[model samples]
Target: MYLRTLYKYKKWLFWLVTIVIVIQGIIFLKQGAVATPFFNYGMYSEKIPYLDNYPVYKIYANGKLLQGNDFSIQGWDRIYVPLLKFEGKDTVNAEMIDIRNRLLYKLRLGSLDRKNAHFENPDFDDQDFYSWYRQYLSCVTGVSVNDLLIVKQDYQWNGSRLLPGDSLVIWPTIP
Candidate 1:
C-alpha cells in the first residue's frame, strides 16, 4: 500500500529531490565565492593558526575592573564588541577591501584604483570615541563611568592555562 502511494507520487518526489541536489551543488561550487549558510561544511575544518600571544581587552569602569561573568552575554557583548571593532578597525577595513576586490574581479569588474578606496574613516576621532564610549558604558552598565580605562593584555597559552604577559593601556593614555 505504501509502495503504491510512493510510486503514484514518484514524479513529484523525483523533481523535488533533483531541485534540492541542484541547489546544494550550486552552493558547493560557489562556497568560497559567497557565504551560503550551512553549505560550506569545510569552513571550520581548516586548522586555525596557533599564536603565541593572545590580546585581551580589560575594561575598568569607575576604577573597578568589569568582569565578564558579572554581566549577561548580551551586556558583555555590548561592553567588548565596540572595543574589538575600534581596535581592529584597520584590519577589518583591509579585509573588506580584499573581499570587495575579489567580488569585483569575479564579476568581471576591475578593482578599485585607490588601494585605500574611501574605506578608511578619516573623521573617526579617538578622543570622540573615548568620550562617547564612556557615556555609552555608563548607560549600558547602569554605573557612572567617571574614569574609563581600557587595557590590552597579552597572554600566552601554555598547554592548559593562560599566562599573563605585558599590558598596554589603550584608552586614557598615560603621558
Candidate 2:
C-alpha cells in the first residue's frame, strides 16, 4: 500500500516541479535576465569577447551624492550582473574606465531598459520594480525610503579623473 501511494505521488511531484519551472521561465522571459539567475544552458555566452571600455555615471541619493562604496555590492550585483548584461553589447567605442565603475554603469544601464511590463510607465509608485529600486536605494544610501530622493548625474573624465559633467541631473526623478 505504501509503495503504491509513493508511486502515485511521484507523478504529482514531477508535474508540480515542471509547473514551477515553466512559471519561472515565463517570468524570466518577461522580466529580462535580472529576474532570474538560472544556469545558462548554451555556450554562446562564453564566446563573447571582453570589453576594455565601459561607461560610468554619477549617482546621488537624497540629494547627497553616493560614493563607490555605497553602490558596490561585493560580487553579484556589482560584477556578475553587469557581465551578464553587457555580454553582447558594442563595447569597442565605450570610453575606458575602471572595471568596478564599468560594471556599476552597466547595472544601472540595464535598470534603465524597459524590458518588463511591470517596469514600464515607471512614474507609478506601486510597481514592483519601483519599490525594489527604492529599497535598493535605501540600502545603498542608509536612508529611509520615505525620505530618500535619488538622482543620476553626468561625470566628465578630465584626463586623469572624473569631473562633474555640467552638474546636471541625468536621471531626474526616478522613472
Candidate 3:
C-alpha cells in the first residue's frame, strides 16, 4: 500500500523538483549576466584614450551611483546612458562591412578582423546593417540592445562615450 501511494505521487514530486531546478538556474544565470567583466588592458591602438586614462567609472543603478569596478547590469534599465533613437536607414555592402570591422579592430584588441584580413563575422545578423550602423553613429552616449525598437526610442547612450576615440582613451579601475 505504501509503495502504491509513493508511486502515485511520483509525477508530482518530479514536477516539484523540476520547477525548483529551473528557478535555481535562472538565479545563477542572472547573477552572471549582471556581473559580466572585461579587462581594460593597454591595447596597441587607441582612438580615444578616455578609458585607458580613467579605466573605471562608478556603477550606476536605478538612479544610484555605486562605487567599485564591478559593473552590474540587468534588463534595459541596467544600461544607463543617453538613449539615441536610431531611425535612419543605410545600405549594407562590402565597404560598409569593412568599415565596422575596421572600427572594431581599432577599438578592441583581438578583434575578429585581426584574426584574418578577409574575416567577417558570419554572426553579424543585423540584415539591415546600414540602419544599425546609422543608429549607432547617431548615439552620442550608450545604447541598450533591448531598447533598439522604434516604438521605444530613448536617446542617451552613455556607453558610446566609453569607446576609444582618435586622440583619447579612458580606462576603468576596480575600487
Best-fitting candidate, scored by lDDT: 1
- Candidate 1 C-alpha error for residue 106, in Å: 4.9
Encode model 3's per-residue lDDT on 1-175: one tens digit a residue. 5445654789776666666656666656554222223223335644753333332222222234433233444322232231222112122245766666776778875356655545444544343443454344235224333222222212322565544323211111113
* Full-model lDDT for every candidate: 0.81, 0.47, 0.39
lDDT of 3 at 119: 43
Candidate ordering by lDDT (highest first): 1, 2, 3
Q: How large is the C-alpha RMSD of every model relative to the true structure?
A: 5.0, 14.0, 17.4
Q: Least accurate stretch of 10 residues (summed lDDT) in model 1?
A: 31-40
Rank ordering of all candidates by TM-score, starting from the highest: 1, 2, 3
Off by over 4 Å in 2: 1-57, 70-128, 139-143, 167-175
Clashes of each: 0, 0, 41
lDDT of 1 by residue, 65-96 (tens): 99999989998999989889888775347677
User: What does the lDDT read for residue 131 in candidate 3?
Assistant: 43
